[model samples]
Target chain A: MPAQTIVPVEANLINALEDRGLRKTSARSAVTTRIETASGAFTAEQLCRDLPEVGRATVYRTIRHLVDAGALCKLPMLDGAPKYSVARNEHHHHTICSRCGAVEEFRHSTVERVMRSLEKEIDGDIVGHRMEIFITCSNCLAESNRGGSSGR
Target chain B: MPAQTIVPVEANLINALEDRGLRKTSARSAVTTRIETASGAFTAEQLCRDLPEVGRATVYRTIRHLVDAGALCKLPMLDGAPKYSVARNEHHHHTICSRCGAVEEFRHSTVERVMRSLEKEIDGDIVGHRMEIFITCSNCLAESNRGGSSGR
Candidate 1:
């Protein structure tokens, strides 16, 4: 019988990670995988749901590390918890349901164009800006019909 | 000796507020003033610190009501509470401090222009966008040199 030693996984990704002083533990990889596979913005609790063995502190650390390293971005919700999304080259924003608290991704660029025109219009020494669109999603609409949320 | 009944102070702001179905209460005006004077983003708790008489529940209710009416907007933060800001006619973004958590506004149109051009290049229909530029504030930088935040 032969005993097996630990074989390092995620060779390439871990190498890039090590260059930035990040640990290549299973928890890190699990958190990364979950975030990568997420359909949209995620709360820490949501990330922890998939990464069962990961600690809350570890999840917070991973989020901070990824955000600092430009691997992810944080979206703050009005309800207190912040949501994290994978950073990408494409510019995007979210449309959140106000009534039932649902979040969805909507692709549109008029916001970008308007921001650019405004910068030219003002001599205020243009910098950067943010855009968030709020919408009542279809699921929330259904929920509203079922007497779940008021003021829809 | 005759004493007169105190006439309810009906301020013009309250009169205008009445149009929206909200009562003309002192607490409501104070909350509105705080939101109006806030330089950047602020949480309900932070707003309460300035006006001790305003209850947390009142702050929450007022903020929610204003946001529902489109008179205000919520800025997503990286941590802690979700900050609220008054809605404006044009679009803009914020840069927040990593240390003291102070926020500074940025408005470089080049970034905005590039986003617009990029959207067109990809054949994507443009709608709206939020741009946030994260940066360390000077006060936090100074304090960090001396020591660190007592606690944020």
Candidate 2:
């Protein structure tokens, strides 16, 4: 199994803030610690709901700062608001379960090869890409097969 | 050059509406026609702006109906609102220029093969996928090469 790693967000966020001449407020510290400990992608609203002590505006502001400081990457979610994940060194894509809202990170050599080929074929300077595969997890499939009602 | 095909929206929308038992209103007809004739993906706000005669609510409602009926597909746009395009029979993906707002459609057998392989690796029933490549188009590249300021 691929090792699922948590980003060193607290240190990074503190360094980023100091480098940008921003103050190390308690709110920023709290938000960064929460984000650092989060296992998967999340939305700003989710952070607010989970961390009731953190103000909504503070969560939004800290999120923006983290994104701008390259500590987080915003991902587009279908049929809902966008989500944010820790910025990692390696390039990877996500396979999301439509039924259970589970996201699995994946990387493949073929994907990189195809992207390079497309860059040449289209004669464009490729900057970035987003690939999301929507799937029904095996658990969800099993439940549905057993005549259980499936929910999105 | 690859053929840029226009989906026959009029016939498809009419059939889709009838199958769903939805009314064939003039507003729906007008929006469908506009979308069919459109050369690229567009947002609902753009439709309302362009077709001032069409009420905003009507445009939104028609868009919802068409999407539910499978006559249109919603595409996620980075840094902007989601866009809608006419649904076609064939599976294809898009490459968009971040600088110039240009879009190019592409298809490859390798992408399908990769998705199928991942379905087993992740042990999920893959249902759908979204792939969007962000690029700097040749025109934008050329302009930037010439030391011209590029706009988003």
Candidate 3:
């Protein structure tokens, strides 16, 4: 099983700030703390609301900073606002459970191989890619199999 | 090779408008013409700028309506505004050339098979997914092979 664990987002923030030759102020710390403990995908608006002490500009800037630093990932939704999540792995994709809002990190060799083969067919150099698989998670599947009602 | 072609955006708009019990107004027709003639991908702001006679609200609303109707697809960019493109095919993913901004629609069985297998591993039912591959198009590859500079 590929390791499915959250990265040390605070450490990533500190490292990113250091790389940019910046200091970690109290506001940054507060935002990092909130993000570290976030349950699943969140939004900048939610962060701004939760971190009232931090300036809205600071919140947005900090999120953008971390995202640029590869510390955060955005989950693109088809019909709604995009959501943000901590980068779980250096080279992994997401399997998001639509039913329970659970996001799982996964890495598979088969997928990577398929991506590499595109170089030949497209006759181009493959630079980067993004994939998001939406599903009903395992737990949700089990619950539905048992015909139990979910609070969600 | 799978069919790599643009969908009939105007027909799609007409059908969508009909489904909503709406008529094909001149404004809608103008927007459709612009979209149909768009090279690869476009933005709402660009469309609004090009069609000054169309209300900004109408431009935004029509784009949303057609997007919901599966006439247009949004190319989610990593560092900039998401670009809009005509949906080229049904049940196909995109390969965007970073060099020339060319978008190619492709459907590969291996990719689909891998996605389906996720059902067993994730213990969930797969609902939907989106994949966008960034690459250099075949033409760009040839140009680069000849050591020629691209205008882009």
Candidate 4:
């Protein structure tokens, strides 16, 4: 497996607050930290649950600010509400693990080429595109192969 | 340009209700007719507005039932709530017009080929995927080219 290059969107919460012209507050600081260090995509409700010390309103506001600041990426799910993840500066797509809820970023030249090629055929001026793939991650696949049905 | 083919998910509301074992209420009939004849994607609120005689609760419940019955397709937007379109039996992707808010369905084999190819490289068992392209539709593009900046 290739090494996953996880890049931090913001080095610290303070710089992000300054960039967005948002006031520095303890509640915002805690929420920013939690978001930056999140291992996978999460919902605002999950963040509220994780940070009982911070007011729910504060957490939601900080999340909105970060999203507007382009520090977080919001993914649209097929069934329920959207999820947010720490944003990466580079262009890429997401692969979500159905079993363990892991999100991985990937980019392939062929996929991009196909997207760009659509410009000539499609009846529109293509401004942007989003693609999300749902999968059972390799870890889960391996576990299933080994007769482990716990996660299922 | 190739002609777009849209096959209906259910021939009629009565059949759809029958398949789901849902009682064919008058309110459900009204909502189902409105949905089946809709020209584009719409929200539950839009349906409620269109069907002023039907109760809001009935419209919402009917939409949920149709979605579950595979009669409507729910599309997730980037920054706002998701919208629903009449379901087409065939597999396809959506191209949304940013200027006019029109949603068009299309299918490209090369795009599907690229998606399937990802399974060999990615660390996951591919289950499903979604792709939504944002564009200025041909009509919008033509209007823009004609020095009509009204939509802008």
For all candidates, state DockQ relative to the true structure. 0.21, 0.65, 0.58, 0.75
Among all windows of ten consecutive residues in candidate 2 chain B, which has the lowest summed lDDT? B1-10
What's model 3's overall lDDT?
Answer: 0.79
Q: Judge candidate 2 at residue B65 and give its lDDT.
A: 85
Give per-residue CA lDDT, model 1, range B1-152, as digits (tens): 44556434433333335668988789998988776666777877898898899998988888777777666666666555667766553455666555555555445666566565545343223345555544455565565667755535
Q: Which stretches of candidate 1 lie over 4 Å from their true place?
A: A1-16, A37-40, A78-80, A90-127, A132-152, B1-16, B34-41, B88-152
> TM-score, each model?
0.59, 0.83, 0.81, 0.84
Prediction 2: B-chain TM-score: 0.77
TM-score of the first chain in candidate 3 relative to the native first chain: 0.82
Please give, as one word, the docking class of candidate 2. Answer: medium
C-alpha positional error of residue B38 in candidate 4 after TM-score superposition, expressed in Å: 2.3
Runs in model 3 lying further than 4 Å from the true structure: A1-12, A138-152, B1-12, B138-152
Highest lDDT scorer: 4
What is residue A82's positional error in candidate 2, in angstroms? 1.2
lDDT of 2 by residue, A119-141 (tens): 66776888998898888888788
Better of 2 and 3 by DockQ: 2
What lDDT does the true structure give each of the candidates?
0.63, 0.79, 0.79, 0.81
Candidate 4 lDDT score at position A47: 95
Q: Which of 1 and 3 is the better model by TM-score? A: 3
Give model 1's docking category.
incorrect
